[model samples]
Structure formats: C-alpha cells, structure tokens
Target: MTSGYGHGLDRDRDPLRRYLSAWIGFSAGGHFSQALSVAIVLYAFSTQSVRALMGWPGSLAVLGTLVVLATLSLVGGRHHIEWHGILPVSLIALFGFMGLSVFWSEYTWATVGGVAYAVGFGALGIYLALGRDLVQVVRAFGDALRILLVVSLSLEVLSGLLIDQPIAFLGIQGNLAEGGPIQGISGTRNYLGFLATLAVITFAVEFLTRSVPRRQAVASGALALTALVFARSPATAIAVIVLIVAGVALNALRRAPESRRSLMQSVFAVIVVLGGALAYAGRSRLLDAVDATNDLSVRSLLWARIRELAAVHDIVGWGFVGQWPTEIFPYSTIIAPSGRPHETGLNAFFDIWLQLGLVGGLLLVVAGTLAFVRSWITASGHPIVAYVWPALVLVLIGVTAVAESFVLFEGTLMTFVAIATIAARKRSWRSRLPQAAGR
Candidate 1:
C-alpha cells in the first residue's frame, strides 16, 4: 500500500533493522548446526579409538554444556529445564536412584563416574529437545548415523586393503580383511549391526514421513541396508524384522478405533509377558531340540552361571557402577569359576537387574514402558513428522532391549535419551501441528 518512494526510503533506512531481523532469526541456532553436534558425537563414538586419543569425549561434553548454558542464559534459567510432563520425572527418578546408589556402591568412585556420564548425556538430550522439534531431532540422528556409516564403510575398506593386521589402537579389527562379518568401524559385529539397524529405521522415517530429498534418502537407506547385510548379525536382522512388524502394526493401530487400540495394547502386553515366561520355562528343552551346543551358542551357559552370581546380590543388585570391577563380587566370581572375568549380563533386563537389582530393574521397565506408551499414544493419529519417527525408533529400541543393552550403553544411550526427551515433550503436539501440517 505504501508508495514507491516510501518503499525506497524504507529499504534505505532499514539496513540495521534488516541485519537485526536476520540475527533474530538465527539466534536460536538453526536445525543443521544442532544436528552437527549430535553427528559429531555419533561419529566420534563410531571412531572412538581416534577420538579417545584426541580427548573428544571430554571436549564434546564441555561443548554441549556450554551450548546448553548459553541457550539457558538467553532464554532464562527457569524456562530452560522445563521438560514435559510426568514421564521425565520417572526417568529422573531412575537416574537419581542410580546416582544415589553410589552411597552404598561397592565401587563408589566408579558409580560416581558412571553417574557423571548419565547426567552429562541426560543434559545433552534436554538441550537437544529444547532446541529442536521432533522432526529435526530425527534428522539430527539420521545425519549422524549417515555420516558414521560412511566412515564405517570407508574404514573397513582401508583396514582390509591398506592394512593387513588388526588396527587395535583404533579398534579396527580388519573385518573386511577376513571373510567373516564386516564389523565396520564399531569393531564388533553386533555393535555395527545395531548401529546400522538404527540408521535404517531413522532414515526410513525421514524418507517416508519427512521431506528429505528422494535421492539422498534412498542412498542413505541403501547404505544402511548394505551395512546390515554385510554385518551379518542375527540380532541386527531380528531388530530390522521387528521394525517392519512394528511399523505395520503401528499403521494399523493408527487406523483402528480408540477402543480397539486400547484393547490391542493390553492384549499385546499380555502376550509378550506370557511368551517370555514360556520361552524361559522351556529354554533347556528348546535348546536340546534345536541341537544347540553345550553353551547354547555361548549364551545359555553364561546366563545360567550369571544367575548364581546374581543371587549373591540379587535383592538390591551390585550397585550402579560403569563396569563390574573385575576384582569385585560378580565379576570376580566368574573368574574363579570359569577362569575368566564376566562383564555384562548379555541380556538388557538381566544387565539392569545385575546392576540395579529387581527393584531398580522393575523401575526401569516401568519407566521405559510408560514412556513408550506415552509416546505412542501422544503421537497417534498425528502427522508423520510428529509421530512416526519417534514411535518407530522406540519400537526398535524396545524390541532390541530384550537382547541388547543399548538403553544403558554409551554409544546408543544418547539416542535413547533423545527419544525419551522428545516423547516427554507432550505440549509440542498442539503447538507444532500447524507448522507440521504446513510442512
């Protein structure tokens, strides 16, 4: 409506105002920069051998802390930690309980150290959630996993063709040098497999629900699938299958009536519990029937022996330290019995029970299950960008929890934290719907 002369005057007079406008738009640190920090941490862990030497872990923690603090400074302290509803409380209780266990911990300093990592990672998740939307969070992880996969593939090639021997210093195991499963840069077949599975699902969500470029998403998905096939891990394969089933089930559940959805959830829970009980009760017969080895592929025997060890501290657990000290009770027990030290329980629930006892383990189960249900329900019937990414990833995580310790382990713990944080952000549904629909 303004005259041409007035428009020219406006442009001429608003130079500093234009700069301020751009600065205001950018003051929040746009999506990709936030994604970059996450990607760096992810890639750092995948190539931890090099990162350890460079002290990247400490540096990342400091950097994340500074970013979080700076953001808080800009947006007032009280508003900074304002996490979503009751879900975070349960998680905080779980972590706080773990931290408090240090008082009774056999290895006090070790618990202190583990607690430090938990707190640091938890804070990072808060920062990530506070800064970005659910869709952005998914992209951050997708970008991180994409870069890490490329690094993994490249390192494997380098290790096989350029170096004949194991690069133990960098944790490169010359996986491609041999004909066995390609461990990628993760150094272990299972670890690489797990990471690849995560990548597959993350990229899948981005491709299906978000507006990622078709070529890029397709290429990323292919890379993840290639890694999955090359890694040749049964656990990873199982996780992928579960993701498929979950995605289909979730799609159907989304379409079903609310009453049916509620009933279906209950039925699913009952079946899972009953199925687990039946599997455990008949494991020996099942093993024999399958012509399994004496060790049942080296897991059953370990599990059986670990149970006896667990009974020693079965009530309250051995306390939440980073690792079972080889010289301590549980770890030391196996050294005498089997002539080797034991590290983990091999099963996620068992591992938690081993560290935090039945009480803590039960608490973790409740927290995780409630969080999963909350995320699923809140995200239900919402657009893809709102629900599909998190709901699917939670499915992968929940299913894998049966066999793997990704929930508590270092490399994937942040992934879990980010999921939990996003799931906790319930208010985002209403606030983000319009913006999401526009996308």
Candidate 2:
C-alpha cells in the first residue's frame, strides 16, 4: 500500500521511510499505540478502579495518558489537517463548544479538562482517518479488543467459577447470587454487551476481508457471541442485530444505480423526519404502550427526570463537563427528589441537551448526524474496499447511539476515534497512492 501523501516507504534503505514506518507503526496501534490510552481508561472504568482510587494523586493516570496521546497524535503530525470537511469541523465545533462552556460552567476546572480530553481524542481520530486505511484502523481496534476481552473473561471466570465470589473493587458481580447479572471486568452487563457488539462487528469486517486465518475469525466470532449472550443487555443485543441488518442494507445500497441511491436516501430521510415528528407528537401514548408509567423502566424514568433537569437550565445548560457531581447543587438537589441515580443521559442527544442546553445540543446532533449521513452517502458509491468499512462502522455507531453515549463523552474515547475515522474523507492509500508517489 502507498502513502496518501507522495512518498516512498522503502524502509530497507531510506532512513526517512524507516522513520515514517516506525512513527505510524506505534502511533497507529500496538502495545505503545495511541489506543493504549483508551484501553487503560476503559479498564479503569470497567473495574471501577478510578472510584476506588479517588483522592489519590495518580487517580486519573489513565485519563491523563489519553489526553497526552490525543494531543500528541494531532500536534505530532507534520502536515496540518484540512479542517474544512464535515468530520473535522463537526468535531472541532463539538469540542470547541464544550471548551467555551468553561466560561459559564459551574465546574470550571472539570470543564476545561473535559474540553482538552475531547479535542485530544478528536485529534487522534483525525490522524487515524487521514493517515491510515480502514483496514489498518480496524486491525488496531481488533488488537486492543482481544486483550480487553481476554482480561474480561479471565476476571469473570475468577469471580464466578474459581473464587465463587464477587470482586467488589473490580466490579465483577460473578455468576453467583442466582439470576444476578454478570458484569465481568466491565462496569455493567450492558457495557460488556456493548464491547462484545463492537467486537463481533470488527470480526465480521475482518472476516469479509479475509485478512485473518479462518480459525482465528471463527474463534473471535465465538468469543464475541458468547460474551453478548451472557451480557443480558437488551440495548446491546439490539445494537448488534441492527448492525448486521444495516451491513446487508449497505451492501444493497452499494449495488444500486448511482442516481437512484440519492433519491432513495432523500425519500428515507423524509420518512424518518415525518416518523420522528409523529413519534414526538404521540410520545405520551407511546410511553403508555410500554407501561412505563407504572413499571418505570430505566430509560423511561431517566428521560422523565432529564426533562425536568433540562428545563431548569433551558437555554445554556448546567454544564458541559463530566457527570453532575452527586454532591453538587442541581445534581444533589435533584437525586433524592427524582428517586433515580443521576448518572448519564443514557441517550447521547438527551445527554448533550442536559449538558449544553437546547442550542448547543441541537448543534451537536445536527453536526454528528450530518457527518454520519455524509459518510453513508460516500460509502454507497465508493468501491467495496472503502465503502463496506465506513458503512458498517458508521451504521453500528449510529444505531448504538440510541442506547449508548458513544459520542461526546470522555469514557467513549475509542468510539470517538472510530466515528472520526469513518466520518473522515477516506482514500485507498493502502496501495496505489503511496506506490505512485514512490515512482
């Protein structure tokens, strides 16, 4: 494969080639890869280690690493990123808004750090997209996921079968307690499911590409499926299923005539807008249908409280930093009254509104959706080499957004990377471009 920028990669002789190769090799992925930062943070969150280490000077070590990596990935690049595209601009705007929010945010220090975190991750994402091919990025994710899943499974086994006890520090609930949910090394069953969903999709793409041996593919698929089944998260289950369906749909879309595809997309967009309007208009009736009033499902009740919280800070939101601290004003004041843990918005869009208010939140939604849709359109026409990758990743991320805060959150650093890469202007730099430059 060739470099997108005109350059020879004949590392056997050229010192410059060797340097570029080494730079990208570590920066793109592996043990010392930029992804390491993300892995450490997820591990901390999964094991609830951060909470345990609260007040310690090195508590945010993982997050600190993440920020450094993100910043380095962007600032380390010799070539300036072209920020005109939807992918770059949306990310800049999203993080930029959060940065600006520091002026008005109650938690000023947290907001400032949060902005740096967002942009830092955003920077890494831009590098990944602009510098590498879809296959390489997927491989990096696959490598990281393998280690995570292995660690997670080991923890589950230790807690459930071997030790026959929950590991409170690691948040492993174990398989005991008769009908209890299995959290493994993840924070919750749903989070495990979420990771597994991403794994299966990654494995699927690798399988389609035939990049790995058949046995390895089969093993990874089996592993992901096993984890998903054990997770018991309805949302994660729906996400994986939707990913498969969307993949098949993208395949069909790619095969369609070029002109007709745009027409089809337009019609679908119209239908979606109308359906959303209808749904909003009859939301009360829809909520009743789910028996949410009496049962108060997790999402149902969370939404109910979110509305009230959002109303209190109608225009500019309470803050755009981290979670509403349990001890803080609006959060502490509302928790007992609402009767539900004021954790996350559960829905990405709702959460943004909770943090950034109506205007900022709407900007976040519009920018992100436009970027996703633009990627979708680009994938519809590009050759399968480019198209299938973004199509699958974008759809998976987009579908999963309904139930997961896969964007606009620090914990979702990896998701941000994936989203940025897929949404960036892509190229087949894997072969022709670099070779052309060499010649």
- TM-score top scorer: 1
Report the CA-based lDDT of candidate 1 relative to the real structure: 0.67
* TM-score of every candidate: 0.78, 0.76
Q: In order, what is each prediction's RMSD in angstroms? A: 8.9, 8.7
| Stretches of model 2 off by over 4 angstroms after superposition | 1-59, 66-87, 176-180, 266-296, 336-340, 411-414, 426-439
List pairs with backbone clashes in candidate 1: none
| Model 1 alpha-carbon miss at residue 98, Å | 0.3
lDDT of 1 by residue, 94-180 (tens): 887888778877777777877776666665565556666677777777887887889878877777778666666666677675654
Candidate 2: deviation at residue 186, Å?
2.0
Assess the local accuracy of residue 35 in candidate 2 as a C-alpha lDDT between 0 and 100.
57
lDDT of 2 by residue, 362-389 (tens): 7776666665775677767877543466
Report lDDT (CA) for all predictions.
0.67, 0.63
Q: Highest lDDT among the candidates is held by which one?
A: 1
Clashes of each: 0, 4
